[model samples]
Target: MYYTLHQLQIFLKISELQSITRASEELHLTQPAVSIQLKNFQDQFPIPLTEVVGRQLFITDFGKEIARAAEKIINQVEEINYKTMAYQGNLSGRLKISVVSTGKYVMPYFMADFMTENKGVDLIMDVTNKSKVVRSLELNEVDFALVSVLPEKLKVDTVELMPNKLFYVSNYDRKFPKAVSKKYLFEKIPLIYREPGSATRNAMESFIEKNNYSVHKKIELTSNEAVKQAVISGLGCSIMPLIGNKNALKNNELKIIPVRGLPITTTWNLIWLKSKNLSPVAVAFLNYLKDRKEGIIQKKFSWIEDFINV
Candidate 1:
């Protein structure tokens, strides 16, 4: 192919943002320059890489495949650069991480600390639902993934981070007696669930199943923010991770629906594919987590401890 890796990188960025303008802004290039490079790159493919519809840019199926290849090439090149830097005793390169939407609450602190200490490290964090995070790890698109639950089927290395305690919560206006039973919660309250395949939803379902209780799932939402909004609007109650809902809980916008044996506890784990050759930066991060796990969690998650019994 006549296209340069620089052009391929731009193409991948455009595919991600689906806007040449946004890609150009991120790449520090002018829009016309980005468009020109994109057009030139697309010309090399027999089929069009993208289509413009209603002023919106959409990557064609062919474009997606090409973008995937571009992603691989970019990662390999980054790996080589990172390895070379490692030989020279430099810790400078990009680190890609995929995090479950809920992990957004905690990861920024860790990222900030790491980046502050290592000025040359660039971190890319994709905040998505559990399924996409797993897919990214499977594709080796990210160096690591921050998740609450580990998939048993994928051969991976995991380091336990901290407890991810889940709570049954509802709008502050919703009435909950001082104490209630699982039966009362199941029969009285409507359950708002995260989308299917979500780790939070799965954990809630597993709790119900383990306790031999039936739940009334009334609403399904795509994101944690959506679920919180739905609950706050008095649509229904939801089982959610306490880490993400600390502010809402502290402000009394949302309240715990206290029941017997409440706050089902899960764990947060940092995972990576076992077989993949991890870069030096990735190894350094793992080591950082291992060596400073307690201080990091205590410093970042200490606010949560006052509210929940961690």
Candidate 2:
């Protein structure tokens, strides 16, 4: 009954992490300071909130319940702050978005100006595989989902933002003829692939099937950076998006192979469920994208065109 919000916050952090040490590191407080706060917080309650055995710290059942309550309290407090800012004619709230891995390259550029203008807004972006991004969108867990491939099952509205071009790339040192054959690239060359659930992998598979090319799958990687590094290491070539490979292509770490029907293209879209009501911040972001997407692409992503054309 007599606990401070600071104490509740510390306890909540400790409960979530189950480690005073880790909670301190995340909270930017010294271990001793966190320990003192946790002890003070525990003193006000009659029941045990946490326990330690061997080397592991555990939050008790009651502690977990309290942590849930604490989270609600914190969220409510944030809402109050946002409401205060809104009353002053400022758009203020958390803007949450989940993006497919390749989307990391594109979404941030779109968000940068909006975030700079709205200081009161909090941006939470999760960069994950396509399946997870789609799941987040399906659950309405995020305000928007950024992806190159549209989910087939979701009834969603989308704002088309930019072109996502996929191309075959190899180590810069690898030699290719002026006009490379798709059959040679797929059947002869060892090809790196992304893991199954990746949008890039789906795109690559679709291309291979469409062309009836039997690919030699050399290695499978989970992320774009990994696939890029693998190709750079001379492991194999991959069909990768030009957006993520610009620096590599520019620096000659990787080279685009000019095969026929190269640079498979898709539009990067910001999608939200049609049934989900848009929050003020979410609506503002959509409006911002409508007004500024072309300009943002022209400024930040125009370089990608050169790579795609190769």
Candidate 3:
């Protein structure tokens, strides 16, 4: 039942290269050594394998099938080896992560950089709204989640990475200043708010309730992109994460509300079950994150320097 991998490699190389000379060159083996390995393989397998047509040699149908199976075995062996090495160093398993839609702008910057250094690690991701990000972690559908609100009374550990300041953005033509009181900010602008039950909506509502401020009449919508488009068209002003419309801000399509207290400031946290058994790969990535626990943005993302401890 056991066969030498060298012999199997020899068979596969020969089957693929066809010519003995070419297979030998491809394997960095002398022709005679290639021949001997194939001979060993044929003797061990319970079937005919090689034949000659004039001066050319060929493998039988069963031989080619066995060669294909050998490829699978080699692939599996390599996968195991890479995983083992990655795990031993720190990270080496499938790490499933979930994040709020806004994190689509932030998390990948860090995740990709870390993964680039860990050759053996693999990352799986799900991006959704903030509420679903928390639910996925609580339901164990994902190992970790990036979200704005940290769930209380849950057996989870959270690391705050950065401050995501919500800004009231409008076209510069609106002539809003850089610092406005909470009362003045809400009273002046027509609000373009996120949909009811949305995480952003919940956060905004809590802030408004705590301050006892009445917001001006405004439109409510679901899609972040749509909201940005509305703001660009000057349909009205809306509050959004800096991460949410960093591009629009950069492009000068919209500007922050001059009144500073109108929007709000919040932090983003990475959450995971306190008692979850992390795979080696996941652990490697997590540890790497702890070291860089600040936050990451795209190469040019402006958030890296924003976190005091990062």
Candidate 4:
């Protein structure tokens, strides 16, 4: 019953990716090498870690428990290494961040700049839904979670980063008036909505309920990109975040309709569990964000006036 931390890491990567090939690609190892390592790691435990069904891999409940423990071990080792490195006055460590889907457009810029400045820092970023991001924060799985709507139940420390604005968008060919009334929006236009549980969908629903209005959902899509494509294809209009649709709007693939009371504005926030121990890298990144907050605002959202005033 012997397994190296490296093997545990390989197993965790495979579990995360759910594919040997993908894990191999991410780890820079060949498929066969990854498979051998996974097998060796699994042999150390009596219970099956993973199961293959119809060419797809899935981690069992036991495997999930093992992964949880493995993550803690990995974090502990990383913390020890970084603490030692800190004594040497080196800024070399890993920063794990989980960001909501919409943050994909802006977070890379932050990561790129941070990584460029601290060449020894490794960044592990997960772009996921708000629910998953919240879950990660609750589990202390990441150093920080970036999201628009902070969960009310979680005991978290949050810093507002920027604004997240949802605009009513449609194909440019629709030719709707720039400023239509809310009544006209609900009655005259069919809506293409995101699937249930999405932050955008939930926010829009809450807004509708608060305003005592009902909008028809003619189409439902899982992702923002899908909703944008549906609008581009003339399926129906959707309330979308302007963060990810910059290119689309710029190219006239989708136009922001000037609906009255449009652009439901929300604030982007960086949240982390207050109970979790903050690593040096996490502290550094938080400080970096604070120091560069103004620059981030100007760089990421300088064009907001164009949309807000449209």
Name model 3 segments beyond 4 Å from true. 1-91, 175-188, 260-263, 294-310
Colliding residue pairs in candidate 3: 90-284, 91-281, 92-280, 92-281, 93-281, 177-258, 180-259, 180-260
lDDT (Cα, tens digit) per residue for candidate 4, span 84-112: 77778889888889988878876886666
Summarize candidate 3's per-residue lDDT along 1-310 as a digit string, tens digits: 5679888788888888778899999789999998887887788777878778999998899988998999998768767977678558744556789988767776787687788886666677887876777778888888888887777757888777777767667765665556656676677677788876466777777767777878777788776777878888887777777677756766788776544354467777888999887766667777887877554533445543442121
lDDT of 1 at 82: 73
Give the top-scoring candidate (TM-score). 2
lDDT, model 3, position 176: 57
Order the numbered candidates by lDDT, best leading: 2, 1, 4, 3
Query: What is residue 202's positional error in candidate 4, in angstroms?
Result: 2.0
Error of 2 at 292 (Å): 1.2
lDDT of 3 at 56: 92
Instruction: Report the Cα lDDT for residue 303, model 4.
Output: 81
- In candidate 2, what residue range of length 10 has the lowest lDDT sum? 301-310
Candidate 1: tens digits of C-alpha lDDT, residues 148-207: 989777999888888888888889998766666778777678888888878999988887
Clashing pairs in 4: none
Worst lDDT run of 10 residues, candidate 1, spans: 175-184
Clashing pairs for model 2 are none
lDDT of 2 by residue, 1-310 (tens): 7877788899898987789999999899999999998888888789988888998989889889988998899889999999999999998999999999989988999999999999999999999999999999998899999999899999999999988889889999998767767788899889999999998998898989999988765679999999999999998999999888878888989988877887889999999999999999999999999899889989998787666557
| Superposed model 4: Cα runs more than 4 Å off | 1-8, 28-84, 177-181
Report the number of the highest-lDDT candidate: 2
